[model samples]
Target: MKKYLFYVLSFFTLFVYAQDRQLSLAADVWPPFTDIDGEKSILSDLVQEALGRMKINSTIETMEFAKIFIEINSGRFDGSPALWISDEREKYYFFSKPYFYNQLILVGKKGSDVSAASFDELSGKKIGVINNYAYGDFDKNQEVEVVSDLSNQKNLENLLSDKIDYMLVDALLIQYMLTYQLNDVTEFLAIGKKPLLVKSSHLALGKHVQNAKIILEHFDEKIKEMIADESYNRILELNWIKADVDGDGKMELVLGGNKAGTSAPQNIYGLMHDNSYKEKNPPQRYYVDGKLYETWDNIPNNYKLDLVVDSTPSIEDTYIRLDFLD
Candidate 1:
């Protein structure tokens, strides 16, 4: 009886430990994705939700960008939800499927006479870029004088002040900042039509972690399920939905509010407009979503709610309603 009791107790303890197991994660402050203080991070939310579905818990720690790679490789943290997979990192990490696509573009002031379809065309010019950012073609270019900064805002400020002839930044970051952080700065900046760099991002688990392969497999399954169920879109809380809102069998780009991941303007359905001024005042206006609402107070209780994913439309072609233009 004594031996049986001991075995039962041991089994119970093992079960409890398995139930309480958690994955420790770390990432850098990539805004519109992860935050510095680890608050309201969209990527964090998606990762946590996916892990939770697998009955696995996680804790994310925000750290310096460069340090995240080194520490995770050294087994300091379990993994990162968002990382660009590379040859060096592949040796020490198990990477999940691409969850995010990052497009790096060049931005210059309006009518500055700096036109280039490729980075090579801008040789001998001074360009500002985020320090530690892995820009494939833009990095290690001896022809261009590369100015390093820690953030996009700093680079934009440098561009505005003529400290740099051009600036490089993630396309999504630029749009998010224009909508939420730097509304006034939008008028003076013009994003290049062509992207300088494009890469897919993934969740990387340190090779040192036990059962990392199985964990990554489960993560991939859960994340894909989230997208199918539309839970992934909710986690992003973006301003636009790519679905066909007009029932015309083609997807029409929709805009939501002043910012993504925030409440839309009260009783307003944001509609996209033509690029009348190019970079200056890319047109956006508020209209009624379901029922025509001229005032916020008159919005109907039965109006349908529309949600958007984190997909940007191509500048060359997009469906827009001219009647909705303000």
Candidate 2:
């Protein structure tokens, strides 16, 4: 009996040690997704919190984009929470399942037609894109002039100046602006209903890092667990929720709110908007009072209470509105 107890205690000790493992990670200074010290970084908050729930601690340092991989490969960092897959990068890193996505949606001057089924439809249009960014199949349409440049800020400046007909930017940035910075942003920019491109993002460990594969596999499992318990939505702190809650083999747009609102989300946001999704008016579900309602129509009128917001509220306001300008 004493021998069996000794083995059980030893197993528990090993389990505790594994759970307390720490990881040193790195990411670039990409706003709305990655920020210095994780002040305003959504992905950083989500990844860090997700790791914490998994009983794994992590520290992610923000650096220049070019240096993120270089430092990881040199063993200065163990891994990165933000990673995009490529043949060259796969050589040095073991990637986790796609935990996040970098989705690019087209933007145009207010009142400009920002509708297109594909890049082929936008032939002859001059579009602004960030330099060194990989836009899937966007280059195939040679007729559309891609004005690649230094940054999104430069592109926005050019777009407002009418230097480019349209600009491609990450959808998360659009959501952030709509929530926190949209008061000035919406006056000039009209966003496309569909995304131009979607890049799958992963948590990756350097090949030289110890227990790289095991850590990645465990991280993936914890991500799904986080989503199931609604902690993922809390981490995002935004109204958009994407998950296959209905188990329909397709994802649904869900709104996180105290009350589900009076109707569907006017401007639905996606974590990764599948390029193939061609629905003109996709439906949005709402989470209210800890219950998931399939639609606003099904919601009881008593539960449709809206959070009052001043029409001209402070920019620091963190409240969410179901209505969004297209």
Candidate 3:
């Protein structure tokens, strides 16, 4: 009886020690998704909570997107929340089951009539692309006008100004840009009926990390459980659902009123014209002193305004602040 008791105690002690092991995560500010605003990623939060329920602790470190990938490859971090599973990457990383899917799209100006029936048709056109981004087969042997900075607003500006014929960008990111930054001057038309590339994103474990394969297997099982129990869907709904900020059942905010200042008066007023609120809404809003502020700079850098609202508010306002990192 004493031997059995000792065995049970040893098992419990090992379990406790395992539970206390911290899982290090590397992430970047990929908006409406992963960001480093005090445990603010919806996917990250869900994963963290799930880990907690499984008796694992995790600490996320936010860094540049490029650096995050580099660190993960070099085993400086244990894993990253979302990364594409590619052949080149497979050599250095073990991937969990895909938790989300995304598409790479070709975005052109609204009125541009430059649709190509096939990939072969874009042979000579100056194609703007983020440096080192894998567009699957679409990127193979294609001549591209590479933009080293993928998230820079200037790349879109160049596309709008006709410096480049078309730019390859993430579909969701293009939608966000149209809703917020490039609404006035730029619009995106799909270059082809099919996506330029379709890819799945997974939690990637570094190759050099000890027991990486085993860790990835555990992560895979957890993800499967989350999906089977419908927890994954709940997380998606929490992050992706369009929110109506103006109480219109639509997601738009109309700002054209008497209070709009003269310098940028027409710009704000134009938002309300022709019932634009019926269309898509902004993913987030910036407000100060009960009045909605338009631009990022409008909010005093020091005061830290009243509210920074999201399409879906996951964490408390004090814990997270939203800004266009790109």
Candidate 4:
């Protein structure tokens, strides 16, 4: 048994180190999350910090979104920080378990009924979408007129001017906007409560990369470590998120600041939405300082102070801003 264990450990070690310490990744200009310049980007920070802990030095090359796959297939690049999975992509990409998400929700002018449950109900309405994005089969419905744009900024402009009935938006970008600047402008924008599409964001490496499986395994482990240490929230620059900080098998409203608001946060971000996929309404219990609180009202007053964000977020506070196409 001792000899068998040694061989197994050696095999694992060999498998993990097959690649060099260096990694070359690429992405397009997906703002707040990732960008071409790779500055003050939340997703980039998460990727760098996670890889840094694994002692893997890395560089991200930014190009047109279409070019990312081209470079990866030719072995000119290793992988990307943000990519959505598909059937064909599985053949060439070794994907890490999603570190976060990109939830597309419908947005309309304040007080507009953006609550249509499905595209079938949205027939004949004009919808704004980013060109070349995978919005499932949303663009296929004959009655729906799909308007494509270069960026969300253009879509927002069009929406505000009544050029389009509704626009699909990523929840993370909206959260980032509210967290930083754009809080004032949001009063004019009414976001739908339900998401139109919830897509997972993953770090993907070409299958041809050496030890791609082991590298992703290490990355996934690092993500868990970062979440446990609160470094994930710190790097993400969010006030808090919903997570199971303690190993008690229940979720808690994990705070980054000294205190959180009294009310149960309406949209406390979750690190992974995979749980929501399984249980439509998962039990959300709170754990703090080693105790579990079943109800928000039952919690002590000291732990529930309102978190006030500045009207204008600073560079030191969060990632890059998606300030109106202004």
lDDT, candidates in the order shown? 0.61, 0.70, 0.53, 0.75
Ranking by TM-score, best first? 4, 2, 1, 3
**Which of candidates 1 and 3 reaches a greater TM-score?**
1
After superposing candidate 1, which stretches have Cα over 4 Å from the reference? 1-20, 113-115, 139-142, 181-183, 239-326
* lDDT, candidate 4, 252-278, per-residue tens: 666564565777766666666545523
Per-model root-mean-square deviation over C-alphas: 12.4, 5.9, 13.6, 3.7
lDDT of 2 by residue, 266-289 (tens): 655555335424555564565454
* TM-score, prediction 3: 0.59
**lDDT at 302, model 2:** 78
Q: Please, what are the lDDT tens digits per residue for candidate 3 over residues 198-286?
A: 56667777877665555555566666555434455355432122223334443322221122222221212111122332234443443
How far residue 26's Cα lies from its native spot in candidate 1, in Å, is 1.2
Candidate 4 regions off by >4 Å?
1-19, 139-142, 161-163, 179-188, 244-250, 274-282, 289-302, 316-326
- Candidate 2 achieves a global lDDT of 0.70
Q: Using TM-score, give the best candidate's number.
A: 4
Q: What is the TM-score of each candidate against the true structure?
A: 0.65, 0.78, 0.59, 0.83
Ranking by lDDT: 4, 2, 1, 3
**lDDT score of residue 233 within candidate 2:** 69
Candidate that scores best on lDDT: 4
